[model samples]
Target: MSADVAIIGAGYTGLSTARYLAASGVEPVVIEASRIGWGASGRNGGVVSGKFRIGFAEMARRWDLETARRMHDLGIEAIDHVGETIEELGIKGADYRPTGSLRCAHNQVALDALRAEADWLTGTLGDQAISMLGPEEMKAETGSRDFPGGMLNRHGGVIHPLNYVLGMARALAGQGIRIYCETPVTRLGRTADGIELHTDRGVVRARQVVIATNGYSDLTPATDAVRRRLIPFRSAMIATELLDRPMLEHDRSYTETRRMMRWFRKAGGRLVYGGRGAFGKADSAAAFAALEKAMRRQFPQLAGVAVTHRWSGLVGMTMDSLPHLSRLDDRVTFSLGYNGTGVALASMIGRHAARMVLGQKTDAGLLTSEALRPVPFYEIREPAVRLVAGYYQFLDAIGR
Candidate 1:
């Protein structure tokens, strides 16, 4: 098989790349190991978090203030881009909701920090969409008294993740883009003309290749270096039975400020809660019980609520806690490491990668410009991740 461009992984990023490439009159072949949206793209909490893993102050401390501000603004734009694409394309069955999101603080100290961050975002960054919510306001908005305070971003919201990606896949299929499910690329090598991707069925030769396999990079040998730079972590979620009303007052999605943060939202009359999972395990009965215990602590009213579904997915975590996009060679481009904020950001980055493949300049700014260094002693990343997870839990316990 031969094509102008080839995309591996049919998750949000890969499908988004294919969509834009097709729009540019380039029919790209997309290969997926499983079905479309079978990874984190479909298994996430469905929150369109218009923010990054690192906060604005941390971003400023690491980089400059101006660069930090621009990156934050770019995240907001990425959220808008997703909403625009869904609306413009008339993508149906996505359950797209612009209900916004709330970042809750676990304690008074965290609340004070949240207030300061809100001021910085509104005053310095001129982000009028974000506002601080005190305890009363937060309780009124979220229907939970566990949070001391929170910040609300009017631009952030939620969607049916599986439906969203599947909708994009259907639309791309209508445009004559070849989508081969259950077709995994085992190796990626450079050919004299361009690049060659060897799969179980056959080899696909394309002038340019986009590696969209974010958390599942271990599936492709071409991304070994990239894989070492990313620490794959499992995140698990449980969906409760349909409730009487929305779990949140305004149906707003929410996340706490802890290292092992809890993200939850009301969707389809069910309360969906999720967080980081145990090291080296995808889904387990113990993990689900722990998550349910956390949920009960947060919302005691649902102590006996029935959990209808439990699921888990891998998330690619970068060393610096930021997403990385780069062009490895003239014929190879890739984007990954979303740090759990991939629903919207991945789509935007995928488009940028597509532009890069077409030899067009993209405005990725510091994201693509920053070098992605591999984790130290990455060969033992599994045990290292376990240690890191324990450290985070310890910090959370002491409230440091």
Candidate 2:
């Protein structure tokens, strides 16, 4: 098989790349090791967070205030693009909610920090996208006194995750872009014409390759460079049969300012609560048990509620907690490292990648500029995530 471009992984990134490339009259084929949306794209909490873990103040200190403001604009651009896609395609059953995002602070110290960050965002950057809600307002919005305050993004919201990716695949199919599931690229070789992707079925020779594998990127000889940097940690979720509390009518997604990154939201008649899983990839009963305990601790009324379902998915965490794009060689360009906020970001990164393939100008800015350094001692760190995860939990406990 031969094509102009080949994309690995059928998640949101790969599908979006194919979508954009096809729209530009470029021939692109998508090949996935598993079915489409079999990874994080299908299994995540479905929040279009449009957020970065790093606050704007810290970002300004690291780089410059101008760069920090640009990052904010980039996030909104990503989610807006996703919103436009859903509307243009009229994706059925996506259950998209434009009700916005509420980032609750677990403790007073965190609340103080959030308030300061909100001040900088509004004052220094002159940004009006987010606002700080005090304890009283947070209590009314979240129906919980555990939160001291919250940072509200009035644009970010939630969706039916699986349906969004599947909808994109359907639209791509309509455009004659081929998606082949269970078609893993075992090895890649640079040929005279382009890169050759070898699979059990056949060799696919393409002028260019896009590695959109993200968390699912494996430690194989073909893609070990990525695995060393991609911290493939698992995050799990439990859905309650009944949302016993009064969920905020305005907020569609609720995430807490914790190192563990716990989140929950109203989904129809139920509530889907999720957080970091055990450090290992293979989930344990202890992970779900911990989730239940944490959920009850946050809302004691949920102790009697029945957990209807439980599941886990991998998130591609980077050292800097930012998405990255770079070239593997002259023929292979790749993007990854979303740090668990990939829902909207991944698709936007893919569009930038497609534009790169087309040799067109793209506004990726720092996204395409910051090529991530490979994680140090990744071979050792991969097997021993407990030490790392434990430290994060400890930081949360201390409110650092």
Q: Give Cα-based local distance difference scores for all models.
A: 0.86, 0.84
Instruction: Write the residue-wise lDDT of candidate 1 on 13-37 in tens digits.
Output: 9988998898888879999999999
Q: What shift in Å separates residue 89 of candidate 1 from its native position after superposition? A: 2.3
Q: Give lDDT tens digits, candidate 2, residues 197-218.
A: 8888999989999988998898
lDDT score for residue 156 of model 2? 71
Candidate 1 lDDT at 376 equals 92
Q: For model 2, what is the error of residue 354's alpha carbon versus the real structure, in angstroms, after optimal superposition?
A: 0.9
Query: Global lDDT for candidate 2?
Result: 0.84
User: Highest TM-score: which candidate?
Assistant: 1
Report clash pairs, candidate 1. none
* Model 2 TM: 0.96
Give residue 319's lDDT in candidate 2 (0 to 100).
Answer: 80
